[model samples]
Target chain A: MEKRYLDYIDDVVSRIDTDSQTKNKIKQSLTEHIEALIEKHGSLAYNKLDPVEKVAWEFSENLQLQDRKEYSYPWPRRYPVWRRVSQKKIFNIPLYHITDGYNPETGEFEIARGIFAFGPVALGVFTAGGIALGVFSFAGISAGVLLALGGLSLSALASLGGAAVAGLFAAGGMAVSFGLSIGGFAVGHIAIGGEVFGEYIYKTTTGEGNAVEWFRNYLPYFVKFFQ
Target chain B: MITIEIRKELKSGVIELAILALLVRREMYGYELSQKILDLSSGQIEVKEGTLYPILYRLEERGIITSRWQAPLGRGKPRKYYYVTGKGRQYFAGYRKEWNVVVEFMCKILE
Candidate 1:
């Protein structure tokens, strides 16, 4: 009985970080809690309890975690925010998750991962949030493997934002790409803007700035895409 | 039930709030704290047994609560007792106001 209980305690401790001192301290506290449990259960029935049966409550379908008014994850306008996760999954990631809040202890925002993730910080196949990363993304600041749309965005294929950067195409107030770009300040192989810099640059309203070169690795893929 | 999933979902985070509230009243060890929650709430705040440790550890880690072992003046085993820190009291004061507002709104809305 003791051994099985110790094994359960070990399982819990293993989930915590690998600091020996912290682990030992946590182990001591956990053992005391367990002893308290035993005292309540009467040591005879203590071994009958299962911890796994106890833990599924955290992830069950009906779980709702509401954040304080100060937190608005994907957007910055709300008093309270909540996240609901779908049951479906891809690569063990949730199908859709809308979660955003900073951990009080870690002070890091909760990361939302899903095919369609929306939160303060999100990663998914299609993501939209404050800080987004995905194959297709839209946010205040975002990176997209295929296409990005937001205030500031970086994309492998195309980017559209106030300030945009891409390998193939970019269109924004300040746009930079390897292939084609159109913006107020544009830089690309074929650039069109008030102030432009590239192998071929066109001035529209008339502006001037020193040419700044860029280094890129995805230019070959872009050449293939254009071809 | 409109409340099953709601209760379960609301349990974990609010558990911390409840702990701080109870500790503000008086210090208690793990078992006592758990039992009082059940009794006061008419068993609604049914904590998954033994899960209190992790929450207590988290509270301690954040400096919201502290603990010390107390022996019954040379009789039985020493039990670790927990009490709220000054920081916890201040935090609870703010949290209590928030909860009060929330509760008032929820009551009006649900009614």
Candidate 2:
């Protein structure tokens, strides 16, 4: 019964598009909730159960249907937003505007000033939701002046994602940096990963090598040596 | 009886406000929150995981609420507890005021 419940949870999670951290959180919460329900109802096999059981069954069924139909999982509601601009104004001053549509020929990209904004070429101190170019940007592809984080990110200082390139520090599946890089494949002055090539390289054949731990162990000594 | 479609629509509209209001008093885990909603509404409302999780995620994304995982005391797995933020409280106040005005106007019109 536990296995069945776990299988159902895994199935639903597999279909969702999200980062590993968010996905793990969702899975943990769902597992805990189901465990609580099982404790309350006595058993998952109980014939006459309460609302929780009914809802759990229905949710699993829905996920199965969604899977069969090949429907894309709905975007997670908790996607972080950088800023939110209201009515294209800040304190009655026209601080930003979102273009209705992207026209590369016309060169009209979205210029927004909000806690969260979206556009083709988004420009805000903190922005997201499209080829975001900002101080702290997040998008399908993003370039952050200081810190960039996304599926594919480029930054002047630090970057983290599937593929990241940075002037200073980078961490991802594939990462390149001037100073420190950690990933499955990495290149930098100090590189650590499964396949690494750098001036200072720490390569591991095992894929599960802990890059962060390695960094923690060596960073202080490296800092002192430089100082 | 109202149609399932209409019922779902109604629930969707009010669930966020209900969640925010409940979390105002205390932090709760997902299942606990759902159970409270059912009990408080006298079984008039039932919150499904399918519906509840998305709303929770959305609220968190909007920075209205935050969550942390608490390890179990003995043998069970950890649980994620959610608590409303100050922004959530302010938002709830505005939402409650608007809801009251709308309800009052509707009652007058219906009468």
Candidate 3:
């Protein structure tokens, strides 16, 4: 039964993608959900029972999951306003307006936890840069000026490149979220581990910044060397 | 006469199988499935509107059937069409044989 659940998840993941970093994270999230379900339900959910015996109990008993409304805002107005020039009060003249409000006044998009996971890291980096630039200035060293320049340049480049990479991660994550929503997921609570994992993978791959990972990978002995 | 309780249970199971078998033969939208069942039963088996969706979802969850939402030609509400899987076909084929055996056994007992 465990094997079947895992295989089913593998089937689902194969239907998605393997090359994407966010894809892998979402795949892991789904696998974890499946595992937890089987554990909680005790493998009966996937039991290969006789169809005749199964239908009566399974059909009415199992509740279908309703759609998750993740991000809902009012429907955006499509038509643009145009002001015609008049001889009097030309600047204040109001000309035309169009208003169309269709059904589903609430616009909803499935927001993946992974997609939302970037808010803090980006905030942290931007804040850290502001603090560093605020506290540290060219204290009369030629090298200090060069270091500051390099730091600012790297930070600026990281911000721009990071936004693009973050967009890709968001797209991939959103796809998984959409897939899960379509596939029927109802959760009471979710842990923060998945979010952190997603953010780290997204930032590192997109070249946003990961000073700890860089240090661990490149300067293993430099920890005590600094002392 | 079979008891009403037994008859209802039998009918529900049979109705579910009938729906699956119908999809196996061809893809169908929800309204089409309801109409076909009513037609096949000669108007004896009318399904409640609310009851059918859960059954559809269950079949989808089991991977026996899949649904796609598509807009009709010209403007209209999108309908979900369900198509059968290979596994569904195999399950239904065996189920039909078992049903025949049960019916034959019941006939002999009722005589």
Candidate 4:
């Protein structure tokens, strides 16, 4: 029976491509439902039934499928589904990729909702902007150093803020309030270290090359390491 | 004799678990799982492929189960076969225990 349950779990898992977080949600939900099912229907022999037969019986009773392409929910009963259209629809201007935003009345952004609508395009732009800011800090003179450092700090804060915002979209609740506040400060320190390193690069003889050239040499290394 | 409301409630709660538990027994693919569930239920349960995939994916994510791409055995598209994990065993154990307790509690009340 234990083996059977494990096999059952494997079969279900094979059918979907859910991420770890969503998987956890499914697990919790399944645990509850499984318990409920077992309460309602128990051992096959004791109940004069087969386990496989009993399980299938209960499943058919509960699970449902709706084929929207074949059928639509009758009007006035439509649920607000998170429809995925291209970010191009919202702003209609090239390079303006804002998809989801906070309710204007609430005056607070919901990070999770934005992530859903914006998808990877918005996230990529935000991340690239942060990396650019971090890299530029190193190509500075003494006065430029201070400004670069400040910029780096701000960038880090913004990146962290962005991450929390993204997570909020993923998590969907008050988890954002606490996460953003602490994440904001942590980003500041990251900028400080990144700036100091940038200064060293500027002073070093290796700083002769253009920023693009330097990145061209180093970007592959970073990608390889991450991979 | 369960009412429609009771049936709906049961479906929401137990259907996924039931499908998952059945697959744990052997290496039956999607169609087999669907057919088995239907047969067992005396046609009381019927699972379409679309609804089945979402539930299967949700199970896969937890590391409780894993899958492999397999050549077509009999009919339809090339299928992904699933197998249970150590974590799934432990999880099912907990599920079984809790289920027993609930059943016992319910039986006592009904009696």
Highest DockQ, which number?
Answer: 2
- Report the lDDT tens digits of candidate 3 across residue range A150-191: 122122111111111111111111111111110011111110
lDDT leaderboard ranking: 1, 2, 3, 4
Docking class of 1: incorrect
Ranking by TM-score: 2, 1, 4, 3
Give each model a TM-score: 0.44, 0.45, 0.33, 0.36
The Cα RMSD in angstroms, rounded to one decimal, for candidate 4 relative to the true structure is 20.3
| Model 3 lDDT per residue over B6-105, tens place | 2444655676688898998889876678668767767777543233545665677798888786667884445567898988788788888988999899
- lDDT per residue, candidate 1, A66-111, as tens digits? 2322243344533123455666888898899876544322334678
TM-score result, candidate 1: 0.44
Least lDDT summed over 10 consecutive residues: which range in candidate 3 chain A?
A178-187
lDDT of 4 by residue, A1-227 (tens): 24554455444433322234543444443333343334445644123222533343233222221223113333222222222322343344223322232221222332222211232112322222222222212111100111122122222222122222211111111112211222221221111111212211211123231333333465555323211
Highest lDDT: which candidate?
1
Candidates' RMSD to native: 13.3, 19.0, 24.9, 20.3
Off by over 4 Å in 4: A1-78, A82-84, A87-227, B1-9, B48-51, B74-76
lDDT of 2 by residue, B1-111 (tens): 221222544665588888988899999889888889888877767776766876788789899999998876886667788999999889889989988998899899999
Candidate 2 whole-model C-alpha lDDT, 0 to 1: 0.68
On a 0 to 1 TM-score scale, where does candidate 3 land against the true structure?
0.33
Worst 10 residues of 4 chain A by lDDT: A138-147
Q: Is the docking of candidate 3 incorrect, acceptable, medium or high quality?
A: incorrect
Off by over 4 Å in 1: A15-22, A52-227, B1-9, B49-51, B73-75
Best-first order by DockQ: 2, 1, 3, 4
